[model samples]
Target: MNLLHANDRPGEYPASYYAATATEGERFAPLKGQVTADVCIIGGGYTGLSAALHCAQAGLSVVLLEAHRVGFGASGRNGGQVGSGQRLEQDALEKLAGKDAAHAMWDMGEEAKQLVRDLAAGMGLPFHAGVAHACYSDAEVAHARRYAEKLERDYGYDRIAPLPDGLIGSAAFKGGDLDMGAGHLHPLNFALGLAKAAAKAGATIYEQSEVHQITHGPRAIVQTGTGRVSCNHVILAGNGYLAGLDQKVAARVMPINNFIVATEPLGADAAGILARNVAVADTKFVVNYWRLSDDKRLLFGGGESYGYRFPDILKTVRKPMLEVYPQLRDVKIDYAWGGTLAITRNRMPCFVRTHPNVVSASGYSGHGVAMATLAGKLLAQTVQGQASGFDVLAALPQPRFPGGAALRWPLLAAAMTWYSMRDRLGI
Candidate 1:
């Protein structure tokens, strides 16, 4: 099944809390006739929108095509926590790509975080301050402390502090690390702002323009449902929905479904869920993350499914939310939604030049809010013929899945089931 249409309707956003609160903006017309541009972007998520914004600012004529509405996928439906560093920890990165390269990666991550902060401030979007990493086991607590110290001593990042006892009311955790530099925001609002900024910078964005194929050549042609864009360069930023667009990318980057739910406003009792307004993510293989909405409702994300169709969202998420905060057992669920996000085996974002003029980046794991935005900037830089930073990210290992896209899902499902079972058994 096509992930793009497997769980959601065409040209419509999911019934997500984010969609309900999204800022009003222009509904870009769908691409119709033959179009030409300096850059043809084939997705309207963070990576595509950020690339459009930067490329437009650089004086490039751009046309962005989206399968559905902008931010209809994980870009808008996520938990919204803008965590720090690469998806993998610093020490893990050091092992994967030497000490110097890993340090470079850390600096890149810092830049990504700052870029989001700057963009949010300019757009008047809320960028809340901290993200607490809650640990369940004592061993996990010890590691959180060690990791905090490692960041301070080796990376010069001193924004993290350890907490012996976990979050405020949730007794599910023992202790963890709180990073002041990391935080959360309204994800859909942020995405809408990016689209608006890109359009304001002179980039033409076309909604409901589902790209089916790309005719690669000196000047590549991006063919969509009712239109085609012939451009000097093409960027594939469809993420989870990019299966048929490029097999090379699909080989390395595959889609996974994640679910989230929003609870009825807790009003005066919201502080009991979390005293400070910070977001909390626990150390689980299939992680549990949550934060308070602007109006005091709990917005929690949990569970993972490796299927084309989504499981029951409210049922899937409520169980885990209760595991974290059992007090929320009787609270009403205001909204529940699911979205597909891509992930690589290494948990690193994949950056590749499919063709000399076609660049594709995806598989951010769960760290796309900041890194995906940065990937777009780097994509634009590469298109502008200055690829120093892009080169660094692209140089990292991007191993193709053993069975390719067609068979990888089943294999992954089996492996993930084992791991999730381990998480249940607390190994």
Candidate 2:
């Protein structure tokens, strides 16, 4: 079963809360004949749209092709947290890429958040501030405090503060760190704004134009079912949905399914769950993330499936949401959906030059909201012959799955199952 069409219809966005709230723009016609451009972008999520907008602003001819609608994938369906720093903490990054390089990576991460903030502000998007990292154990709470202090002292970043025990309430959370600089928003709206900006800046966007094959050379030819794009450079930004398009990206960036559920409006009671209107992500291998929508519905995301098809979305996600907010046990679920996102072995992004003229970036490991947007800007820079930022990310190590493509899902399922068990046992 192709993951692209496994759980959703072709050319349509998932019936997600984001889709319901998102403002639909003028739909672009699918590619039906050959076209030429300086750069061809595959995928229409934050990454591709950001790249298209920046490249067009730089006066480069650009064509962006999306299999479905823009932000139809994880970009629109995610929990909408704009997290600070890399997915892996800075100390871990220091060990992975050394101090100076890690610091540089940290700066890049800050730039990523700023880009999202500035873009959303310019578009009048509903961007809010506050992300609380809830801890389940004393050990985790201690670590959160230490990490916040380390970030302030070493990186000169000081937006994060530890949450008091009383503020954690009956959610069973011990303590946590609140990052005022990081926040959440209507993810689909942000993506659509980027699409509009890209189009205004002169990037051609083609919806329902899925790329089937790419012929790499001095000039790359990207083939769709009914048309093709001949361009000097091609960017692979499809992430988990780009199944079998490039073996290099497939080998390193494996796909996984995550589910989310939105509850009925709880009115004033919603404040009891999250007193500060901040997003909360717990300390679990299978992370449980949630936040309140502008209308007071709880948008909670949790559970992971290793299969091509999603399990029952409503049932799979509701269990975790209840665990986090038992007060909502009787609340009705208004929306539930599943989305596939790519992940790397180390949970860091996979930025690679598959071919000299082709670059692919994915495997954000649940941190794509900001990083993927930043990636698009970096891709635009590389196309303009300024690759210093892109080079830093591409140099990070990405190891292939031990079982390769065919058996990767089974291996990942086994490993994740074990970790989930450990999480239950509090190990």
lDDT tens digits, residue span 1-427, model 2: 8888999988888888888888867699999999999999999999999999999999999999999889889998999999999999999999999999899999989999999999999999978899989988899989999999999999999999888455444557877889998998889899999999999999999999989999989999999999999999999999998899999999999899999999989898887877777888999999999998999888999999999888988999888787777877899999999999989999999989999889888999999999999999999999889999999988898999889877889999999999999988989
Instruction: Rate residue 266 of model 2 by lDDT.
Output: 87
Minimal lDDT window, size 10, model 2:
164-173
lDDT of 1 by residue, 58-169 (tens): 9999999998888888898999989999999999998898999899889989999999999999999989999999889999999999999999999999999986352568
- Report the CA-based lDDT of candidate 2 relative to the real structure: 0.91
Error of 1 at 416 (Å): 0.6
